[model samples]
Target: MQNHHMITPCLWFDDQAEAAAQFYTSVFRNSKILNISRYGEAGQEIHGKPAGTVMTVSFELNGQPFTALNGGPTFKFNEAISFQIFCDTQEEVDDYWQKLSAGGDETAQQCGWLKDQYGVSWQIIPRILIELLNHSDAATAQRVTTAMLQMKKIDIDELKQVAASQ
Candidate 1:
């Protein structure tokens, strides 16, 4: 923790903090579990978790620090907050899309957005999409946007075709 980021996201889960941490670490490269703290009798009255149960798990995903807490089902994750993964190539995008969306809500997939099994929303975006969307020609950008709006996982080749047509 010598040069940690200024902010780290802390996820709230009912009782899957450790499982979630392990799953996330497995999904991303350059990731690992940093620490784990279990519940103790000190806060038994309020927390209500049994002693020795996982309380918080500190982990890293592709070098980004995150903490998962077994804070009960008081709050749940929604689409309001999401993590965006910017990919440089179609292979990168496809790899992430397949891995992160496994067992997730298929109904939530749209425009490169998906909800994982834990209800955490993620946006798997490609760098080419951003470039096309910001093209100098408004018409070309519009076409790219229109094409993108119709899909779930982004297809870099298809987007390039659309951009070229315009």
Candidate 2:
């Protein structure tokens, strides 16, 4: 087991903490489930979940530690928070987008952002996007930004073409 960080992002789930943890670990490299803590009798009384049920699942996605709490549906995931995955190539971006968005809300996809089946928002972005959007030339940056705004999965080739155009 690796040492945990002082601050970790905890995802709240209704009763799918384990499933979500597994799914996330499978998608990201160097990721795995670290530990699973079950609810005790006292905890069950307070949380209303049955004793021995999953209380929290600690996992790592690409070495980034995260915790999934099976805390009832009192709160839901929204676009206020999202995970950003940076990719060096279009194939990398496409793979992640396809896996994360599988069975997710397709309608929520916009500008390289999508809501997963668990309602968690994620941004599959190409690394070159920053370079293009932060180009020394303001006009070039604007062109890249304009092209990105009209995309959903983010086509790096298209963005490159747009940047090369006059």
Candidate 3:
């Protein structure tokens, strides 16, 4: 059978699959929950989840497919893996940064990286940062890189200022 989504990233949650899916869909535009699967009695012994409880949530965020699984507490999210949000303006960067880092670990934020309340690592980056860093001039790129390293939420204006100062 042909599948709509070929490779979906699965997020392992400790009984928070549905809640997480709801939150994610709310954050991005053109996103919604597509389907849900509940635990069954057949897997009670190994899974330990009660029948009818949410086992998995299939959802989309800005057209990207993802699955949140109530896989117990066997795994947790870390910074090793992260999702990048490329924004065209500073407003977009600020909006995502504020929403995603509302109750996140403050200490973990650096270089446009933040850990959300669910411990999901996200990078809120502006498109200009990429262009600046990949500029033909090496010194300008270094300056912008230094500025970015000192910031938690990337500032498009600051990056622009740094790039032009040289």
Q: What are the TM-scores, per candidate, against the unseen true structure?
A: 0.97, 0.97, 0.97
**27-85: candidate 2 lDDT, tens digit per residue:** 99999999999988885557999889998999999888999999998999999999999
Residue pairs in candidate 3 whose N, alpha carbon or C atoms collide under 3 angstroms: none
Q: Write one digit per residue (lDDT tens) for candidate 3, span 4-65.
A: 87788999999999998999898999999999999999969999999999999999999899
Lowest-lDDT window of 10 residues in candidate 1? 1-10
Task: For model 1, name the residue pairs that clash.
Answer: none
- Candidate 3 wrongly placed segments (more than 4 Å): none
Whichever of 1 and 3 has more lDDT, that candidate is: 1
Query: Each model's C-alpha lDDT?
Result: 0.95, 0.95, 0.92
Tell me the deviation in Å of residue 157 in model 1: 0.5
lDDT of 2 at 40: 84
Root-mean-square deviation of candidate 2: 1.1
**Which regions of candidate 1 fall more than 4 Å away from where they truly are?**
1-3
**Per-residue alpha-carbon lDDT of model 1 for 60-128, expressed as tens digits?**
998899999999999999999999999999999989999889999999999999999999999999998
Would you list the clashing residue pairs of candidate 2?
none
